[model samples]
Structure formats: structure tokens, C-alpha cells
Target: MIIWFTTLQIVVAVAAGAFCAIAGLAGRRPSDFSVGALALVEVLLIGQIVMAIVAPFAGNPPSGDPLEFWVYLVSAALLPIGGVIWALLERSRWSTVILGVIALAVAIMLWRMQVIWTVQVG
Candidate 1:
């Protein structure tokens, strides 16, 4: 994984998570802002997916188990989708809070993926 790109993803994810959490704490229901924040995270994950595919060919393949990295990548991609859908269906303040939790989880997962990609040795 590219250090810069991973850092960017982590920053965005944290910001988005905080935004959602604050909104939820303020008793706000699921709104465009909350949903959009998660959507942005999802977009970043999509970019990561593309990067993962290309990085290997660019001679930056994972130093750890490729399967582990792909598992994390795929699971991270699914999180925002589930969160957004839950928010849409529930349309509650807690749903917004759930979005926050999902975003934070994504950030942690991304960090782990970075380790799997570049830090861990086979």
C-alpha cells in the first residue's frame, strides 16, 4: 500500500466518523450529510481496491498473505454499503451513530491492510 494514500484514507475516515458521531449525539436523524460522509469513505475504499490491483503489477505486491489483504479489502468495502443501507432503512439518530462506528472500523481495517501490504514479511 502507498503510505500517502493510506494516510489520506485514514484521515478522511476519521473525519467522516467524527462528523457522523457528533451529528448523532446532537440527535440528528439520518441526513444527506451523514450518508454522504459514509459514501465518501466507500469511494475511497473503491480507490483502494483499484490501487491494490495495480500495485502488484507495479512491483509493490503484499509482503504478507495476499489472501489476508484481499479479505480485509473486500470486508472494508462492504461496511459502508451496509451502514448506508441501515441508515436509509432505519432513518434514526442511532443509525447515524452506526455509520460513525462503521467508518471508524473501516479506518482501523485500512491500517491493518497497510500492514498486510507493506509491513509484514512473508
Candidate 2:
């Protein structure tokens, strides 16, 4: 995985998490801004996925286990998609809660990705 993209994902996830938390605490539903933020994240994730795929074939394969890398890649790509669907369906504080949960999950995945890459590199 590209460090830059991974870092970007983490930053996006953190920002999303903060927004979700604020919304939940304020007893407000998720706003269109939240959805827009998530949509932006999804777009970035798509780019990251494409980069990952191309890098491997272009002789820059990740040092991590292939299975683990692919799993992280797929799940990372899915989080925003899932968040969008959940937000649209719920449209309440629950939507923000869902986003919060997904953001936490994304953070964990990013940490795991780092660990996996580190193990391989070392």
C-alpha cells in the first residue's frame, strides 16, 4: 500500500469520526455534509485501490501477505460505500452512529495494514 494513500485514508476517517461524534452528541441527524465527506473518502479510496492494483503489477508489490493486503484493500474500499447506504437509510442520529462505527473500523483496518506492511518489510 502507498503510505501517502494510507495516511490520507486515516486522516479522512478521523475527520469523519469527529463529525459523527459531534452530530451524535448534538442530537442531530447526519447532515448532507457528512454524506459528502464520506463520498469524497470513497472517491479517494477508489483511487487508492487502483494504485494498489497497478503498483503490484508494476513491480511494487506490498511486502505484506497478499491475502491480508487484499482483505484490507477490499474492506477499506467498502466502508464508505456502506456508510453512504446506512446514512441514506437511517437519516437520523443513528446514521451518524453508523458512520462513527465505520470510522472506527476503518481506523483499525488502517492500523492493521500498517502492522502487516511492517511485518513484511522487517
Candidate 3:
């Protein structure tokens, strides 16, 4: 995992979490802005996938265990897509909660990916 991309994912996840928390606290449904943010996160994740694929050929393996790395990559990338689908189905505060959960999970996964990378490298 690229350091900068991982950092970016964490930041985006945190922001999404904050938005979800605030919406939940207000007893409001997810807004278009929240959906847009989630979409942006998905876009970034796709970019990360592309970078990961290219990194190996570029003479760098971001993660030593490509299988583990791809597992996290695929899972993390799917979260946002799943969130959007679920959110569309549930438009209330529940959707916001789902978004929050996804964001938090993705953040954790990113951290795990980094740890996996470090362990393999060391």
C-alpha cells in the first residue's frame, strides 16, 4: 500500500465517519453531500487499486504478500459500493449509520493492510 494513498483513505474515512455521526445525532437522513462523499471515497479506492497493480511492475511491491494485499484492497474497495447500494435502499438515519460503519471498517482495513505490508517487508 502506498503511504500517501493509505493516509488519504484514512482521512476520507474519518471525514465520512464524522458526517455520518453528525447526521445520526441530528436524527436526519443522509444528504446528497454524504452520498457524494461516499462516491468520492469509492473513486479514490479504485485509483488505489490501479496504483497497486502498477506498483509491482514499477519495481516496488507495496505489500510483500500480494494475496493479502489484494484481499484488503478488494474488501476495502467494495465497502463504499456496498454502502451506496444499501444507502439507496434505506434512506433514513439507518443509511447514515451504515455509512459510518463502512467508513470505520475501511479505515481499520487500511491500517491492517499497512501492518501486513510492514510485517512482510520486515
Candidate 4:
């Protein structure tokens, strides 16, 4: 569990969420940049997935419920892809808002996964 890496992911996730939210609030459908930001977030999520897989081998397995941790990881990874598909179909500012919500969910999920990775409390 790398602190700075998690922080970077959180920042990107939050920024994507904020960008989509603001665009939606301004009555704009998802722009190219919006999609790009989400894509970036997806890339980070992929990185997280890799980290999760390799960490166990590195002797840094999750300290909490492994099932919960894996669930968060998988969900966070899927959120952006789902949002992208939804946005493509909806084609409205509302779609952007939905994407915004998804991004926020990813952020929260990532934070939870981090806790599950780093914390040892029962």
C-alpha cells in the first residue's frame, strides 16, 4: 500500500468527478475531455488492480477482509467503464452527472480499499 500513489488516484478521481459535475451543472453533455478524464481514472484503477494482485506475492496482503477488499477493487475498476457506457447511451448532461456520481463512488471505494489494505484492526 503506497500512500502517495493512493493520494494521486484520489486526486484524479475527485478531479474527474468535479469536472463532470460542473459540466453537467452547466447543462453540457459529456465532452471529450470529460471522457478522457474518466479514462485516466480507469487507467489508475487498472494500476490499483495490478497493485492488489502483486501485493500478496510481495508479502503485503490486505490486512482486512480480502473479499471486501477485492470487491472494492473490482467495483472501483468497473465504475468508470460503466459510466462511459451509460454516457454513450444517454447523451445528455444527466449522463455526465451520472458519470460524476460514479467517479465519486470510485474515489470512496478506493479509499475503503486502501483502509482494507493498510489497516490491521479487527
> Which structure among the candidates has the greatest lDDT?
1
1 or 3, greater by lDDT = 1
TM-score winner? 1
Clashes of 3: 0
What is the C-alpha local distance difference test score of each model? 0.95, 0.77, 0.81, 0.87
For model 4, give the 10-residue run with minimal summed lDDT.
Answer: 113-122
Off by over 4 Å in 3: none
Better of 3 and 4 by TM-score: 4
TM-scores, all models, native as reference: 0.98, 0.85, 0.89, 0.95
Worst 10 residues of 3 by lDDT: 113-122
lDDT of 1: 0.95
TM-score of 4: 0.95
Candidate with more favorable, higher lDDT: 1 or 4: 1
Candidate 2 residue-wise lDDT at 20: 77
TM-score, model 2 to reference: 0.85
Residue-wise C-alpha lDDT for candidate 4, range 1-122, written one tens digit per residue: 67788999999999999999999889999889888889999999898888888889999877899888888888788889989998998899999988888888888888888898888565
Show the colliding residue pairs in model 2.
Answer: none
| Ranking of all candidate structures by their lDDT, best first | 1, 4, 3, 2
Q: Comparing candidate 1 with candidate 2, which one achieves the higher lDDT?
A: 1
At residue 35, candidate 1 shows an lDDT of 94
Regions of model 4 farther than 4 Å from truth? none
